[model samples]
Target chain A: MRARFNSLPPRLKRGLTVFFVLCFAITLADLVVHKHGDHWWNFFGFHSLYGFVACVILVLVAAWMRKPLMRDEDHYD
Target chain B: MINAPFLILFAGAAISWFFPAALRKPVLLIFPVVGLLNLIALDPSQSWTVSLFDVELTLFALDRLSFIFGVLFHIAAIIGLVFAWHVEDRPQHLASLLYPGSALGVVFAGDFLTMFVFWECLALSSVFFITARGTERASRAAIRYLVIQVVSGVLLLTGALFLFHDSGSVAIRALSLDEPAGLFFLLAFGIKAAFPMLHNWLTDAYPEATASGTVFLSAFTTKVAVYALARSFAGLDMLIYIGAVMACFPIFYAVIENDLRRVLGYSMINQIGFMVCGIGIGSELAINGAVAHAFNDVIFKGLLMMSMGAVLFRTGEMRGSELGGLARSMPRTTGLCIVGAASISAFPLFSGFVSKSMVMSALLIEHHEWVWLAMLFASAGVFHHAGIKIPYFAFFAHDSGKRPREAPAHMLIAMSIAAALCIGIGCYPWLLYDNLPFAVDYRPFDIPHVVEQTQLLFFSAMAFIWLQLNGLYPPELKSTNLDSEWLYRRAWPSLYGRLCRIAGWGQARFYEAVGSLTNALAPPLRKQAFLLLMPWSVREMLMILMILLAAILFLLFLHRPL
Candidate 1:
């Protein structure tokens, strides 16, 4: 199974990439066509931007938290 | 009519002890199915009342809420049993049955007394699974877990006594905050619900449990607390902020924690926070959403835990740092785990999407703008940790050159059933919605909702990929993250050690001062004091009494008549 995945043809790999891009394109298109329930959500790619910003904040905060919160595995012992 | 689901499970636990090894597996599998059937046949309005010592205890009460929880627990029990079927240990099997039985007891309890009894039973029975691991860390973690659970139980009983005193009844119904006992009840439920600062026991202990034991542990305890909070404290305004904090803080810990199971434990808190917020909103839609989410959480969260269990079983490793690239060897487990991760992250067309959106929508309708924003951030954060990090590090990251075989057939079967439920409930929510305590008017699959959710999840994935490409994502390390448990586990012990040293120093100074004073006075006073130390003879006692009498007479004469 690993060999099959590792040896996948370039065309198949490109097809998989296209599939993901198409999915994102559909949601992006919905930003223009669909009437959103909330005005805040109506901005083009609002959720996509919101998701990206939220994740970046999470990573930064976790990095800060590590200074105080991280300890040896047997810190309690 | 004579049987309750709790009784069926408890009896099955007892009978399984006497069964031979070959017969034990079937006995374990059959009990939960029988219990599920018994609950299905139960009448919702019926009550089984037992009067003892002038306190009427409702041992069994089936209502819409209890009915939903009862069915969920039974299903969880069956799935947990299937996952643990390969084990030959009798005690672990007994604990698996009894643990859910106690939770079923909590759900069906109609009064505070009955609830307290089952609540304690839940604590006692569940501890065995942790201790069954037979490692020092597991044993210590179990003890801490037991202490927290027992404290919750004690608080519940104390609150019940006060509630009964004030109200002249122990009925398990919605309570007013004005009641003096209300705070105790809330704290009790808060501890079990893993409410913020009160949540460390879950992360501390769950990762230490045996692999299969963690699967069962994931299902019952915290969800029972969610059920209790919904039953009694729904619409309490304080829960709104409390639940928001609960939802938000854990993602950071999950992000940096090395243990994969502990990460899932943190994610469990994040999921329950949504349900708590839903209950706090208290609208029909919100309550329905909370109950529905609770049901979905058990299946998906249990699925996540089971996958991790399978990983640990194969690799004997729980740390993400030590595990990677197992997808080639355990592809089926990987697929199932991704299903769990997707469901937990609330991806479109998954169980989480169907249920969690109800809470978010209700928050918006109630004009809780800040809370709605926090939950949205949490949704994105959950996608980062539980959704991406779990599968990424465990399965697809840098190969650690360990190629263990796939999980056993039973574990896969259990995971498949749970995975199927996660999708089934996502695609067709009405099967769950129809059983909610309140009517659900909200729709989950509207075009805007689907589009927005997909955009959020996909973009979150993009961020993870971006961080990885930049070499900026934190690597999993072999370490612990300090949480609230630091107070008891580290701070308190260190403080006690310092206190003992100070106390010992004070005592030494006190003795030294007394010893020096005695030594200085000893030469002059020793001879005189030696006479007093001699045993009193009868003649000496008489002479001393006569002298005392004469002194009294002289004093009487000296003050005569004045």
Candidate 2:
């Protein structure tokens, strides 16, 4: 699954991923708006979503770095 | 009073230097016995005096506060000696003596200067324990530990100098926490006590020490700082917030930590948080709680360290990922470890319950509702990690097929002694509470209080179960979870590395420019300068002769004219 995902073309991969993420986030935001009040809830929700996406990107970069550099437990010892 | 403690320390160091390797461990055990005897015999009221640097010294004054901490320190030393009885290293043996002796000196010293002297001694001596591991990690940790410890001591010295200038008194007694010097002194103590952000050194360094060395390290530095804080900054308002945060931050880290020793390290800071918060409250009840919890924490926390130390010693492994199913083979150690976990988690009828409840209850009665709530959350978090996670992963998690034998007799004895103390104090709270520096009005064992505590603990345990069973909790894995130390350890190192590279590049460019300029100018400048001075001696000689003749004629003319 990971290899297949990695094999996708960069532009198609980028567009589809962003479109899905936006849809999911908007749905989640709408659900929150339905349950809670609008102004403060929308404000916090959008900021949190942005932060989450950033964190995910960072994690992906970290994962990429880790692939080659990772060592077994007794590496130094 | 003075003879045995200092003598035993010197004697231990001397024996370690001269004695056979086989005899050193036994001698290490002997020092603590002699020190404990000296400690138990001292009277707080009848202090023996020595004069130093125009200040009166009470080398063995057992103040109410000092007496309790002194006894605990003595007990911790004895327990640590037993735990490390199998260790053969001469440096470790020497360090074991000096570490506690320095703490004893700090506890008993009558003046700030005396305390500062021992305070620095404690820092200098404890580094050996970390350094003895002889690993790169240990070496790095030791350096960081030494730097922080020395910084604390320097701050203490600075505070002491300022204090002397302001108060014209050298006596180490209670002071208002508002003064600049007082804040410095409090920070010095706070760093050692693992006060929130000031804490990283404890967790960063302890896990890197030799397994046995860690047990000794865990007890003294922070508790001594707690003693200092209780003495100086009790009732300081900021401590409440600092302590609350201290209690909270370690839980997440501990939950995800694979190294059981490092997990215990985080737990150590969490336990200290309770004590600090108690000190902040500063009521008789709160102070009593702080002192009592400090006592209980040393025993149970040391017991936990001893258990983990045993595992590390036997397998040379401490990470939870590499450990599991030891209970099948090492049931005694597992049981003991469970006892420690229970005590730390404040399980009802355990030591943590008796002591920690006092601090929590004090917060409520004082009407600091938010702090009370935070303490409650931290309390549950403590159970989530130190109480359950430690024992679960180390003893009874996924079977790793490792049939490690039980700990050595001496290590077991050490752990049993600490475990027994945990139970003893829990069963009889009056024994601990009555001996606290302040009078105790808070009762720990009312029916309603007991029920409420039980419910809170049971439900938190239930929450832990839910999290674990549902796979919602963070799993312990083989990875380094970053802590505040990352600011200096990782981030600053990378920053410094970048800066050094830039500077190197700049230097290379500058040197290249200078080299080219020097190469271009060298031949012409050298030739021209030499050529300007290349006159023949004959030409100069004739000119000099003519000038001499002219001077003589001119002299004759001037004489005739006159």
Best by TM-score: 1
Candidate 1 segments whose C-alpha is farther than 4 A from its true place: A1-20, A36-38, B510-562
Model 2: CA > 4 A from native: A1-77, B4-7, B15-17, B53-58, B501-562
Candidate 1 lDDT tens digits, B377-477:
99999999999999989998889888999999999999999999999998899989999998778889887778778888888887786676566689999
Shift in Å, residue B392, candidate 2 = 0.4
lDDT (tens digit, per residue) of candidate 2 on A1-77: 44554565698568646754644454344333432122232343442343233223322343443445444544333
Question: What DockQ score does model 2 reach against the true complex?
Answer: 0.03
Model 2 per-residue lDDT tens digits across residues B163-270? 888877778877676676888898899788887777889988999999899999999998989998888888988888888988877776676677899889998888
Model 1: interface root-mean-square deviation in Å:
4.2
